[model samples]
Target: MSEALPQHLHSAAYFGEQRDFWWNHDYVALLARRLALDAVIDALDVGCGVGHWGRVLLPHMPRATLIGVDRERAWVAEAAARAAPFAPRATYRVGDASALPFDDASFDLVTCQTVLIHVPDVPAVLREMMRVLRPGGLLLAAEPNNLADAMNVGSARHLAPVDDRLAVVRLQMVCERGKIALGEGDNSVGEVLPGLVAAAGFAEVTCWLSDRAQMLVAPYAAPDQAAMRDDALTHYDNGHCIWSRDDTLRYYLAGGGLADGFERAWSLARDAQRADVEALRAGTYHTAGGGVQHVVAARRPQR
Candidate 1:
């Protein structure tokens, strides 16, 4: 029998409408110019979840044809369906990032968004991406230091006790360490991606911070804000944060957190979540939203 997929594999919570606001079109256009995408005709998107990253980049590459690959068959199907509008110019298939099913030097551009963080061996995936990219081809990756979000101060938590806030940060830090230890990948892998790309033998490496901020203020009327609010509410209603309670507990235990302290940590987190939700409902919730996504770009050395 086939092994069951991970619980987070096909989660709608992540691929929801809020993803559309990830990049500002003008910012993408600026990146396109900087990367000289005008000369790129064939591009590959590895770990292309629902093809969002590819779709976002396609408009900026007027002559490019996109081929997206994902390990999950369901995401491949969804990506293919989502690429319908670009039919002849875009395609999706089931493939792993670490072992991409394509020939060497096949694409002029190879990229992924929030993909490296989930792979057990980021370097292996980078090698594969470089292998499929033509000499002189561009390799772009977007990953984030997600752990930083734990330190963000929201209106609801502004007056929270320092110890309580520290507990939240401690919980996230432990979970991140455990996640990496368990081979589940790093949640904040973006901080070192530039060095990784350079070490992987890619030349002329460069990095930039994503301009979009997920700021949610009173009224929550903007489409993106509304989506964010709804997503949070759904997760809160389900009694979890981004990851389910079970997943968090597993990570905590793996990361060296004592079993006895799990309940207290979890309870603190739940209380914070509840406070945020109540504040949102009362039109009093807001945050500076210092999300830390990094975009790293490099090129395969010309042979």
Candidate 2:
């Protein structure tokens, strides 16, 4: 599995861009507040993709330590790259979510973000998280869902190159913002986190919903809409295939079947992209872009 993770992450566009965004943004700082990091001296971020949070937490935790674990090595590499700037203050390694590589009572806090939905055994993963933290340690989890709205699909061929181009543009923009690309995995957060965390024997847990997405594109403004469209398609195709075993990701990437179905639909994608951009420019998409943020927090029993 370790040998394969690198290919999955590097070739997989989904993680690549997310790592870029995490490294570039303050998303980690925002995450720590939910975890109450000021009180946590050491933290283990389970399934810490690309380890962006480590950099943010290192400075905030003062003399504390931070470690990140992930199934994907390239992501670990990306996380390492981001953490390198922070030096000995932070470190990350390739580790399994189902069975973490750590000793009992190894950490003061265990954090995982949006990882429950992706793993095969949620309870097992939670148990592993619980096992590593000292008694009274904090458990912080935030997993967001991917709900799609105002989305349209169209063929990449037949229509004028501009229209085919626009179809890819809208798909990429909407999916990226929703983090729909990251996936809800297979189940809803409402159904997954509470039951799993409770079963792991956490005494207390808190939940939160967040909605924060803001991006739009009008195809007409792009100088080479065609080139941009191809890039978007390639990225969407590559990313979709890597993280998901779902045939849909592989199907679109394959490209043979979709062209037949959406030949007439290309124009609709352009229309969708144009309308969304216009609404965004007119300040009409405020309600449309945001979605719920689900956060689950737990406190371990006092030792």
Candidate 3:
């Protein structure tokens, strides 16, 4: 069985509770082996949210001294506390991603998961990661083309009416464009990170797809399925879509969604998610909503 989702405080309400359903051990092990992760002596997890990425990767790199940094003090404290059981020497600090608080060439591995999508200046963040990484150090990031994932309508098992699925997809596309246009951040940064990494002077840039899949089948026996149900419940309780309704609305309006269309689009999307939850309860729901996250890795130049 996979590890339970950490019960740590999350800074973002929408994604606060979701966990290892996507970034499981097998996937991390693959990345570790492919990238020679065991060779890393010092690894820095930038924007480490409760140290989930570190927790998943550290066991594979036994010699690594893990360092987790997040802007949220709560996350920093939680990461430190959680890592104490096995990684006693691990450290956690409050810091920014674009301006990492670390010395040049301080670590053999500098990485982040799902963090770059939220940063406006992704190149700056990559440059900082490069700066802190030692010669021949690895810079790895797991980001997603979130818009593509959002457009996956899933099989008929999850969709109540297939016709309306396209509408929801279009709505999401609009919101994504709006989100980017607002100078907030690009939600689809994963697809473009290879270029960004190469542009940042990193060599041997490569990308891989995360092997973990978020397929939810009937009876909901798996821990992942249970977690999904719980997540949907949380979203419902908070009156949020997969992303928060407030944030989605802002993005939608920014993406050129007419004020008049907001209610209809939101209603359709919310009802669809609600249907999915109901299907789960009825033991009829199934979906492969697992995002295709891009693991973009590159090596810093030898100094």
Candidate 4:
């Protein structure tokens, strides 16, 4: 959903820190509107890392009782603590996506953000969510096609050759392929979820693009921009140029990237990202990075 995750990945350090830049309040409202929150009573948030998505959607559904589930106990604890102030009726528990620890036909709404993209058997997870949904209950999954992020257009400090751009793209493709080949989840699962939802026999399947973008301008006074600045700096400190360089390299090599070309490709991509960061510091950076992020919603058929 948010990032492509390998099966072997365990650390939750980076996931817990990202916020405000991508899934902003306006975009959350857009998604909540699409879900049509008129009758939701009990809702489930799958893979709720730190409950960001649940918190964002909570204000829109005043009557809804939220229960968040994650595989990590630490995240569950963090989610509960973070949500306690505003979401009194909310609860968090450690659970897995393929086997939610809930009764069938229990929830009025079942949702996830960027969760399905990390699943190994996406259809199985969808079926499981549907099974737990009350008849006609809504199912919403927000996911992104991250390969688009690799070639995302933005104002660059230097004009590089087309070939250089192509090399970066190629490098990304290799890394993505490697991530999946190594049994890691797909980072670009958003583009495929509509069909998956329909195939699972959910009725009235629909999709909408997230209205969010990586828009940054001079002075960067907007609240979202300020959040983005903080997020970018945090990412830089964590050595993440898209995904972390360490993770990307592991996937790249697993996906069959030549050992010899890794340095040049990685250097080029990092330099490009660093250039944007420098421009941001100088108050001259402007970019609107778009990706194939989709909020696909469907409903279980009434019994």
* lDDT for 25 (candidate 2): 35
Cα lDDT, all candidates: 0.88, 0.57, 0.81, 0.81
lDDT winner, 1 or 3: 1
Candidate 2: C-alpha lDDT: 0.57
Preferred candidate (lDDT higher): 1 or 2 = 1
RMSD of each: 3.2, 8.5, 3.2, 3.7
Weakest ten-residue segment in model 2 by summed lDDT: 149-158
Q: What is the lDDT of residue 278 in candidate 3?
A: 74
Task: Score residue 26 of candidate 2 by CA lDDT.
Answer: 52
Q: Tens-digit lDDT track for model 3 on 252-276?
A: 9999999999989999988877776
Question: Number of backbone collisions per candidate, in order?
Answer: 0, 3, 1, 2
Ranked candidates (TM-score, high to low): 1, 3, 4, 2
Off by over 4 Å in 1: 1-11
- Model 3 ranges with Cα > 4 A deviation: 1-11, 14-17, 156-163
Write model 1 residue lDDT over 1-303, tens digit each, in one string.
113324367444577668888898899999999999877899999999888999999888889999999988878888888888888789999998888999999999999999888888999999999999999999999999998778886889988999999998899999998889999899899999999999999999999999988899989999989988887787799777757899899999999999999999999888888999999889899986778999999999998
1-303 per-residue lDDT for model 4 (tens digits)? 334333234435345334635676777776667677756899999999878888888888888999999998877887888898775779999999999999999998999988887778889999999999999999988898988876774676336678878877888889888878877678888888899899999998999888777677878788777777767766676677767788888988998998888889899878777877877788887777567689898999997
Runs of candidate 4 exceeding 4 Å displacement: 1-18, 21-34, 157-159
Q: How does candidate 1 score on lDDT?
A: 0.88
